[model samples]
Target: MDCDSKTFTYIWEVNLDEFDRVSNLYSPPFSSWNGSVEEPWQLQFYPHGKMSIASSCLALFIVHRKLHHVEMDYTLMLINQKDENETLSVDKHSTFENSEDGFGPGPCIDDDRLDSPPSEGIYDPDRGFLVDGKIKIGVRIPTDPIPIKRKVDNMVSFTWDLSLDRYKAVPNEEDLLSPKFQTINNGEKNTWQIQVYPNGVVPELEGFLSLFLVHRGKDAITTQFEISLVNQDPTKSYRYTMEDTFSHDLNGWGEREVIGRRYLTNNTGFVFGDNVRFEVRIPLDDVSINKLEKEQAIVPFVWEVPLADMTSPTGEYLLSPKFMTWNSDESDTWQIQLFPNGIKSEKKQFVAAYLVHRGVKKVDTSFSLFISNQNEENTETVTMENVKFKYDLHGWGANAMVKRSDLEDPEKGFLFDGKKIKIGVQLATDHIPLKKTDSVMVPYTWEVKVEDLKLGTGKYLLSPNITTWNGQNKETWQVQLYPNGLSTEDNKQVSLFIAHRGDNEVTSRWSVSVVNKDPKKTESRTGTNLFGYDLQGWGSRTFIQGSKLRDESEGFIFDGKVKIGVELPSDNITLSIDNECPVIKEAPACEKCPAVVDSPVTKATPAGNPYDSPRPSPAGNPYGSPRPSPAPINASLHNLYRELKLKTPDGSEFSINHIMSFESIEKLISNLMRLSGSSSNYQPSISSYKHID
Candidate 1:
């Protein structure tokens, strides 16, 4: 049977009575060919089961009768003679060397199940596998050569003896190499040799023996072999087995510490007559020199597009000519996508660029994109390391490469001849694993100048968002300045905070500083906290007093501008998702600048002393009209309050008698009305309070 060309099946029927009479039986030999080699095979059976499974189960095996090596995938089945559909089967892929008679699933079927009733098992006298006193067995096998690029090689062993006395005289720097030997694999000739280092090549193993298998061929090869130090009693030999790839850059792979030099020299079994015999064996048919080689060469691709072509009104993007990372066309193809105007929400703000894979194969690559500037040193470049490009995610890039404005700015010199832009991509053709390091403390600083700081509206002044990196993760952060303080501060102080605007929560140690003319006076506040969507901003609400900050002598204000600096130590920062973040209210908008507002009386007055009357502001009040003083406290209720302090719902406190603002008096009256209803003894008429217009 030329089974290598197609699927082959054979059926053998045996009489159970005869099978039981003979302890062991073999079917007639059948001829099968794999490639050009002819192999004779037979089916072996043990009716009462094999040695270990005797009388408990049946044993079946496919036996090879010739001394040939072949790898095959086969299926063995015990047919239910009564139903056919109810069969017991086992499938396996195995390598067979005629040195061993055969391979099989020992104790193929349980005797109890094989002889059970038809309803409960596969065998029964009238309606199961044992019908008519016979059982049918079948085998299906594909005799084709193993599906590999290279032909399988038979087990081959080579032995070489090293003279320990001679090696002891050799210098540690020298290697003892066995004579080169040739082998043929898949019709290709190759050379290989063994190298033994008396003193290990690496420092850690200097006192040990090092053994390696080196491929002398210029091409790459993958091999599976065993290296053993032959002992006087062969069974006691010390052996090491491994599979590895050998290439031009790495032509050998083995253990640097095979055995301690002293131990090997003292063992009589290993060192016989001052010589140690080392044997190298390719132990399986699949061990061969694979011919397919990996291409590590990198190729550069450049594309120049006219600025007008990218900015044209017709299309959102333009694709560059396709190119590959290798010289051959079979290599993965890629193209550069130039979004003259960016993508999605980033349109018109940034000049986006991406590397698009044009091939079906997934590629692991390290690629860099470059945007050329007139000054070669100032060219903008972005690199993505250890990235993968596949069907699901075929492209990746920065939406904000160089800002569109910056690219078009004549002074920036990004445009060549005021008409074209040059973009280049360098791709690595092969993948190399990257080594990881421990967390490192990286520091970053950002500073911005606020012009007309007091004139800015909204709840706070926001600095431009800056992007920062911690390892492979990136985040956007912005500095927020509340010149008038938060609501709780009551416009008496300036507040400074940093907000994380990224989707992920991060923990970082950060500091915000208000620059002063005198270095010694620079006011800075530091804190470590986890910032996220729920608690977006963190800092001091009383960063600096409004009076001191605005005082000309304090030097906090320079040229009507304030310089704010923020520093972040990213050593401990890590990103994570908070699936259950709570909703937090945003800060209220600033009604007016706190610097111009009159600071409300926050201190308590001496007992029995009259409160200070209101004074008009020279600059005029921004909050409607000036406020009148409050009425005297009711005489009947005077004993109930000595140093009266009224608290608001938001937790701000004020002295009732000294309250000058219209807003504060209204809150006091409201509290009084609510208190009067709750307690009869504290009742006070509305006439006791005065409101200012």
Candidate 2:
């Protein structure tokens, strides 16, 4: 194929200040040609670098947005604004299939080089790539498209014969292993084997024959192949065809019941002189092995709270600084709330910790929390997998993170230098969704016209409901206008409120205006609030003076008609989670524990809202107080027990004498299994057994 030798250049003027503020910046789409076809392409620039290179270098990628596949040679350059001859550049060749596939010229420049002074580097305020708070980036791409590389198929086949009498002589529950064989797939040599069970391995399929093809390669492989039980007559063979990927965790795939043993033994045509043949055919063209890709591991966020902070005479809970799950704009922010003296029933006996969502939208996440130890190997951890956090259900936690007595024990190492405690949380980064780059704000305005204003009967007038989109959710809102001030306002001023008609919580910036004959004289009150079930609406009680609004000379009641307008930023408004009341409940006491008093321990209450007030005695349950509900299962203990099952080979049950960590349980089980001479594959079908007094 002839290459299109023409070269095209594209220039992007980047503002350093804006680049520093955003994680990624994109250039306008440009056109490129693959052979005779033209396709659209764009550039993606990462300010703090991408993935593992973050904060260390600047990265750039060529993105192809069209379906056309293209291969081209390109050069990325960072122009030195002061001296054009000193530009830094790198050349690369890549193949892009679609928008999801992109290639970069590695790290275009080091961060230090871009931030140093002119004497040390080229990126200085007076003389380098970044001059006047801006830099120039350019890319040159050759229109010539490289020919696609083709791979040849290495088709290979293997056949083996088994003695039917020998298979029948073996135990029905035992698997007969075949000798290892070798084959070539896509230019790579691989080993394989076959396993046959005359009678099914599982108890559920006792009279059936099972067959499996196992790959013995060191790496995971994907292949398309066919396996067959050759019959006396060629066309009558039983064939199984499939395409699958096999990894170390699951190295084999086949049918549990390939054929009924009774049928096979009874049929004369199936076996030749007490021998059966099995054949495997694989076309290597479609076979491929998994290749390792560059990835950034999720680093856990750690917070250290002073021991004094938790045990202060003033009972104030500790709140961690807000943090993002990932180093990207789309990442959600989260916070940790720690109650030194646990709330409700566990109060004074345990330490409680909760994970709070501080983001604008809902997110599905799996996360783990850990309490650090002086020796890292002894740290304690609890995990919550596949949980959703939204506006209403914004926080989740364990009421009994650790017993107060155990935490205060000096030898536990939970308290560092007996001064502070370290806590860490790691979020499953893959589960977080990428937020949209462009956020558009839509405005909702409602105008209520009142004729014969003074003749209005009710204390407040309601406007028709308007439906609009708030971020990704739809919400309905209405305007409440009081012609005469609320009774609490002594009827001296008019009142206006923006009521959320929907059931869900919504955050918005709103304004209520009393329209006048002239726009300049319009009187308006503006405020921002999170409207939800706890607080349905928010507004100003003293919106406007009643006399001024009623006077014709004031131009407020023009032509005997009053106009009231309510404006709400409909879209792009952040939906904040409400933290008015703690969303935790008292847990039931363990039946074996001794009875404890329900009266709260006396402590200095921080002078704040009623929500933070000390818990009252059980006998004095006041009205409007948070109701007592069942608390969540102890995550740390549940996680440890869930992975263990203790049952002997003879079906006898066993139980641990005391509570232990998952590692301890695993080690004990391993030793037990070893001493019992049990098969590694033996999985006991019994509940997690524990004996705690």
Candidate 3:
């Protein structure tokens, strides 16, 4: 094979701002095979410089990604950003076979300097090093030029039916409920009940269906469950999940507008044989920790300066890298370019610098840029905060950062032995956007069903036998039912709630309902209500709070059992199919015969709407106010996160779900995509990324 045609290479930048934040900091290891939390090939810098048994110089090590003990060639470059075309660079290339013995350029070229003095030219500015107190570092990795055949992911689905006529029959009444509740139990011996209101009881939520999960067990067991309102027609299903720790004080969780009522009652889509199928699933496992806590942490981004790059040999004016550090927010990248050989005043002996936005749109932010001398004897520190920053493809800040007379003094420590310097940045916000560079939202059908639900007259709390996946289609959700009347201040009313497991922010729209066992009547189930607009994680509003539900005249309960359901009407997955990778994979169900599940739903509520109020308190659950329901999800790759669970080149299993940020998402994907051979039960749904506590 031709060497150039078979080898693939990728380039990235590494910032060394955290060089001095150490009581005991050293270089991190990297690998070409196994990847680490940092990157495939990692870089570490020592401010005081480093010396091997044979060489002496400022040390920057290239460690193999930890655990990745593979033989490979590596290189590190010192680039001058001043000139886009003709700047020179200092590069180091070598090969290593073990992680325990990580390698970088080191000082192999200056091995004779083992006995040199502190004033040596190896890391000194007089030798074309450290461009304006900063350096640009980059790396290249190889990949297989050939592609693999595409394959399809395993497809799983469920179906059930719901008959709505068994409940109350009141057209003009404010609220309606089942004359009796449906009781169910789980494998753990916990009991629960399901309640539904055809017409909402809340003043503003009057037109929607209101569903609830009611806990009636003796123990404080946490439950997980899934419920879906399957459409009878060939449309998508609406789904809802709950992963929760429901105790006596905090027992229930729910949502409104799981789906619209027109589809179920009038045969718009959900009605089939005058009956709509509803499903319930309680799987027997817990979602992974990465899935449970989908939100990752961001921080103070920092970069370092190598005196060798202080003067742009090409007279251009910068020495900053291209990548942002630990950036997860969809926010744009703000950069700092240092100009040692002053921009406008080359004759005035001044150091110039500018800040620019690498992103496309206009951005407003405040940052703190710290420039301090490495020498403790010199108290010279340059600090700027709350500095107004607004920039586009152009730039801002001074053309000359400081007068040459100020940073070059021998005793200043800004230059240790007149060789190196230090600098870093800290920004102030976390706002991720909806669209991304890579990843597309594909469609699929994720469904499950539960049957033989015998809601005898007595009090009962039915829960799924095992935990279920809430949003990801894994086992992360549950349902609670109250067959007997639930306790309230004045009257007896059946109650219910939909529960999900994790505590991450969830943007969802699903349907829940009471299926009328009788198919003769036309108007049967409750109308779908919307959730996540105001009350984030979990959603609930009283469908029948007052004494009106007890009326024997309304024909509330016609029987002892009513099937319930939930589904996702429009769910799009964010996936990146090269469209060129020859690997053969399973065709997405959304194509010719897609399973109708979730869809991107948008419904905003006014201040006076039931959607605006806190979930009403249950007579049994002592927690007076409503609390949020957590859903377990992979935080990174907002789309198709589960696909990242694969062993890295470092021989260790890695999961990107917890590290979903701009840096990791872009840098890790290439390696991760190559490492993964397993597929995921990926369900797609658009989220607002809001935290509804």
Candidate 4:
């Protein structure tokens, strides 16, 4: 290979910002050639410090080998150098411009001690200035040295937006001498150190590189180093205690390293200092290298801060290596940004009381809607009264008086449906009520039915605070049975009897039962009305005090006669008896009535029997005045009329007859006679009767 013949050539040049701005702009070349093409092309510089040079022919030849066209770009930067020390003058437009005002280098560099500008120097690129090689500029050749295989005419000399050439690296080799960082704990100094290293074979390249370190959890603590040196400088270092907060920048250098300590205010026992590290190399000062591959470093060493170490007033929290894990299942590490425990709240409704009717107007029921915890083991019922309308309502009496009337019977309304009322609960002992954020409402359906109304339309919503009364008073009725001097196979077959008129036969049957002296029970049966009055049976007859007891035996019959009359303006009554007792006439006069007669006497006032006639009394009364009849038949008759049973849909028996014992018949009839007078206020539709058994 003719090393002298292979001159430095200009490869493609692009703006650093433009390279980043248009990364996916042009498509990759369709093909590249390895045949007859030199690898590892050379780079050169002009004598002037502002301009640089490279092998334009070599770049063109390789590009022509693979591509049909090529373009050139360049950058004009103020470069200063003294011996090997060089500084690029950036933002130097002020130096390039004539000061309109009296001041020169306007705000070029401030008086701040930390921001002083570097010392100025000069270089002439035309004086054999070389870049990584000897650039034989202005060399004569048999063939054109600057390749003409492609258009180089419209190429810019250099502009505000400039691009610099790139020397493509030889194939089959990686840029192994990449800048990288490693953290080291120097136990001798009891201090943490960050070391920069060149990983590949050519780690000693002369260029620029930067080392950056940021406090992982604490943004305040950070540091950086920008080295324009050839390789890592072990002497250049940064240190901080656990109490301080910081961050920094990397100037320019290749293969750099960075490390920072756990920031502290007063370094007490500061161990395992907290920090993250990153390093990158700068191959060129042009915008392309400054951008496209510039700062090409992994954002590695994210401090895996442990959640357990997250505490208040944190001075130093060294994360355990074993505790490093991702925030989510897929992510490698949790982001350190502040995350909020998202708190949310919602409103829940509760009802308190229902409106009840008084005559016509609605009044608040004294009853309170009771809420009992479903988990009764842990909680109890809570009763609330005076539940007014929600505060949002303007008026005071709105909820106090008004309730949504049930649709079924708006006339007599009901409020809430029967469910939905729930009690709020708190854990017992140290138990805290579930926070609003921690709890949720459980949906429930409520239903209500009103008694006096038709079904299907009377339902309403029952809020947690409101409930309906479920219990009610039971409807009741009663009946009484009498043994009526009759016997069945067991004992006396009590006669089935009804006294109260409105009582249903079925309900009355359940109310009363007949038991003999032995207290054993017996069933009642239906019977006929013997006297065609209150008492009804073949063996027992019913009669008023004034009505004659009639005989029923067929052959041995007796014709009886009796007359009853009430005294004027009083309940006193007199009875005149004229009986035809044939048996008494033929029985030898009955020997002074045998004291208390036991034998079967004539059931009637027999004809022509002198003993059967009422004799004149010295007391002036055969029957007592209706002495405020304890068993007033007329009052019962009135009750019977009012209490008369209306027929129910289902078949059941009922009666309107006034019921009493035979012994009370006299008093009952007299009371009835008094009640029938003009002064009597008891006016019943049913005729009064003296019940006899």
Candidate 5:
């Protein structure tokens, strides 16, 4: 009826036979009938429930059992004004004719009423029942007889009442019972439309038709499908059978959208507890009828976590042990502390000793700490924050602990006194480990408290340049030369030598001397003009000159071409050469000076040391070649000027005398005999005047 698509609603029933020679007939329109007794054919005109007395009692009980062999019994009815709700009723409103006096066809019939007479006035209304009002006996029924009725024109209908609106269920076939389903944690899907609807529409079914999904209750779950066909007719070829038979053809559900994934567990839940109930079992080997002929049923989706909130499971967030350190201070090294109401692990009780000596112990100790919230005017010496701790001492003794591997070189002074007690000692072996030594403007004696002597006394200066250089020593240039006084109120610390005979980058360009001695001309600016030697090339900007006693400031610290020298000075000794070149003085030990060649407590005259014989052979071996007139031996000379003791731009006192002179040996033989002319008019004049004698 209009279950929406086509037409296939049916229900039929038939049962009735009681003599009249219809002989156990209940169909084929009463398989022949008859009533005997010489044509006593008025079975009282039966038409009780109509249909022409149910086809005239199926034609007079098949002509009274084919002329009285006596076996008539019948029942038949039909209705089809397009299935007029399929109405057919029989039970006891029927027809039968058996005769031989067991006369059985009652109701609207030939009843030999052994106490029955409900209707006998049809006048002549029944040859048996009817013969032509057209409702012959075609049995079709079902229009609500309380066989549990609730509207049955059937193309789809079933209800045991669970009210519907589910989250999963629905799968069925044939007879169209289907409504069993599943999908909990998701599975066993398909059926948004496997539509085999000649009587269900959905692309309106055509060729094959086979659908199923059994397991009406207790846990049945099986589904394996892969068929696609959303539309139809592409030269049609639909096949499909899940778990077995080989069907699966599908042409249309292509551009993808029917949905289906399959595979279920927990046996598909219905019972096995947790209150499950998910059904769906379409296994006609999954499905066929040419894969649902013109296809349309699909269902598959999974992603569920709501079994009513299920409960319990989560994790992540760790951080253990990190870093730690400690050594003595008892209680197993103070266990681990950060203190001030947050870290502190407790257990330590006491330990703060120190004083281990391996030789001559004099580490000079002191300890008294305090930092309980220090706040000296918001103190800051460039973000000054100190409190680093890490002191480990384990010097077992016997001197293996010398530089025992730089015990954490903070320039070797190790300390930690924020305080919980730490008195000190292990340091001396030539100390040098006091860092940052407190400051408020400095009066450093290295920690001697009383609010640190209230600060202020810091001026410090001790710079004497040249830290080291020995490219083949050269007696480090006669062992001495001094002068490093440029401040600290000039306490004049002198021992200088920026000497250099060029090596190592040209002896770093030496020359720097001092001892200007002209203090208002008391005379002694000996050779080599008043100091100056600054020659820093390779890019300019550096110059100063007082003509050579050498103090050339490219920031003076060169050690080349030998200069700064001074080792004691009294009676008379001054040889200041700052470099105008030629000035190599050695004189000053007079009284005929020449016997002190090497002495530091003697032993250096070798090569036949007879006192190194020089003047001895110079007396008679005047012929030992080259002694033409030797007599001036110990001359005592002076006049080696080279001055400039400052003040001279009209401020008087800036002498520049003879500047250089050194000839003796009788004025070097009287200027070599007046250049060898002995001029009295050219020599021999004594002989030419012999007559006057």
Candidate 6:
């Protein structure tokens, strides 16, 4: 349920004014104390709407103030603080690349080219949707790197029903200067005015009409809004719009270039029935109050350690020595290690790990181990977050730390490509008090991701090669399974084997399993034993008895393929994550850094066979080195072969010292019984295709 511990939260609050007429606006970047989208982040509000449906609903957006790239997982909300139930939100995972200036998700505006202005939302001011005359929007980011399709969004009270013709410019110069036709526009926090000079106030264009927008707010403050003018007659109802930002030396924006005397005097709707109308929109992107952000300055303390594949191999299944980190405080050290196989003593049958404290002195802290898989498709990507590895004597870990099953699953990135991998450690001290404002939680989180190289799964024709242990990739073997009985039904017997296909003797602690397909019948068998590669091929003839296999009631047969699985014991490790671990800076200081002889990448053997390696073959293993193929082996086969008592005639002939294999003895007895006309061992023959079952 919860995403791994590598997660944090960020909250953004936006307050908008003149919510009805304002098309949209963006707030100043939120300072660090509040929250940051990795950097300064601003909120964009659309009183009218956003995106495709701007005509129907109001919307909010996020904008990055800097021209850098970022990926974020966000949850945005439009909350009616007065009425908690009237909250709206959108969740999205967005990535923003560097823009010439700022990269922002717009309010229906094309950043590259403007084909049109922002579309308007259904705003009706008379319905009273504002809470204390302001709209508040909130955004929360959960995943750090991380949508509303709802019918209930049709609720009313957020728009304006008031007509645009309520206010107008007078017909004459004398009246235009009158107090009745001219007034100030009131905003939630500041005030501004529009002055119409029938007689140009500036001498340059005396005969032309002049319009000026003025901001009477504070000197250092800035305000952005939209203004429009309309000729009310049905024949001339189109309105020309202008978006404006006013502050400091720039008090307003407008000019006489807006119209010609002929266009205005034409009975010609300009003075249609003697009235001029206009609309002003000032969206509230943030609260009206000006804010002063305090300074934030503190570099986090971070440490890095490379997990080299030394001193341990995948085949070594018992616990190994712990890897130590240099102590940051010189008080206590942290220890860590991996168990390629599962830790059997604890019944933990998966890759296990731990974080332990080694020094006598302890400290208080927490850490997150990032076993990162750079491969996007890898499921083994790990972020073990917020581990409180105590400064106490012992440590915390197990094979279950990174579930063994997940490691073995190809899709799970854990070690699907067993290679040289990097394990990251992030440390964070307890809450540290600040000199000025509140305390800060300083964490040493790494910017780099988890990355690893892989050892190959060898190539083979008749057998499939698999690598069980990932460390140094030494313990690799081969295996192939026969779903149905290997031979025809008449003498059908499920077979499993360990082939001697490589150069050296392959030693394995293995398991063979056969599951009954029918849940109701529920019959199965699991056998485990130690195996050593000797002859050409070794293992069992009866991994599952043919008689018990075809029993319709309790047979092991499932679909067309009989399920046979093979597993072997891996290795173990004992380590811990100490809150006070020192950073491993040099290889010489840490004695555990093994002297490694890197193995050359083994190329797929030229088509022939792995057993055809150029190396000389050892005695009985006529093949090169005695390498074993990976297949389930029946333990009883080895024990049965040990009781051999062969009879060789005293002649100059070949060696005949061997025990009767169950299959051979059964065939001989079956023939004798058939000659006697007995029905005990009779069986119907099967097709080759069916034999593959």
Model 4 shows how many backbone clashes? 55
Model 3's lDDT to the true fold? 0.37
Candidate rank order under lDDT: 2, 1, 3, 6, 5, 4
Reference-based lDDT, each prediction: 0.56, 0.56, 0.37, 0.19, 0.21, 0.36
lDDT tens digits, residue span 73-143, model 5: 23333333334454232322223232122232322334332121122322122423212322223322112
Model 3 stretches astray by more than 4 angstroms: 1-301, 313-315, 322-332, 345-348, 375-394, 405-409, 429-693
For model 6, state the Cα shift of residue 9 in Å.
7.1
Pitting candidate 1 against candidate 6, the one with the higher lDDT is 1
For residues 597-627, could you state the per-residue lDDT of candidate 3 as single tens digits?
1111222111111211123213222222233
Give the per-residue lDDT of model 1 (tens digit) for 1-693: 224457677778888765555767777656454542334567887665565544434477887653334678887778776676767788877787542365675334444543232233444555566767677776777654422334434757777666554344333444677655555665566666777877676656666677777878678877676666666755335455666677863277665655556555443467765467887776333445321212344445778788777763312778776554431112355678887876766366788889886432345667889898889899989999878776411687877888888887889988888887889887755332111111332333333334435532124555545455666676666666656654442355665666676447787655566778874466665444666442266655456776787786898767766777666543356422221111111211222211122222322111110011111111112121221111111233223321245554434454544423444455555676576464434433334443221
Query: How far does residue 510 in candidate 4 sit from its true spot (Å)?
Result: 86
RMSD of each: 30.5, 35.4, 37.5, 47.6, 49.5, 32.9
- After superposition, the stretches of candidate 4 with alpha carbons farther than 4 Å from their true spots are 1-6, 11-342, 347-693
Worst 10 residues of 6 by lDDT: 445-454
Whichever of 3 and 5 has more lDDT, that candidate is: 3
Over 1-693, each residue of candidate 6 has an lDDT whose tens digit, in order, gives 123224433333433443445566666545221111124456666554545543433356676543334577766665545556645555677875432122223223222221112222212222223344454555554432211112221211111111112111112231121111111223344444544554354556444455555555555343333333444432222222234456644266654433433345434455433345444444442333221111112212222222333233443332222222222111223444455554564645555555555332223444544455547454232344444543322445544656545544546554424533444344432123111110111111111100100111221112233334423334434333332323332134444443433344544433334444543232222122223442233333334444565555565545443444444434331111121211211232433211111212221111111111111111122111222223223334342331223221222122212334546544554564476676754642211012110
Clashing pairs in 1: none
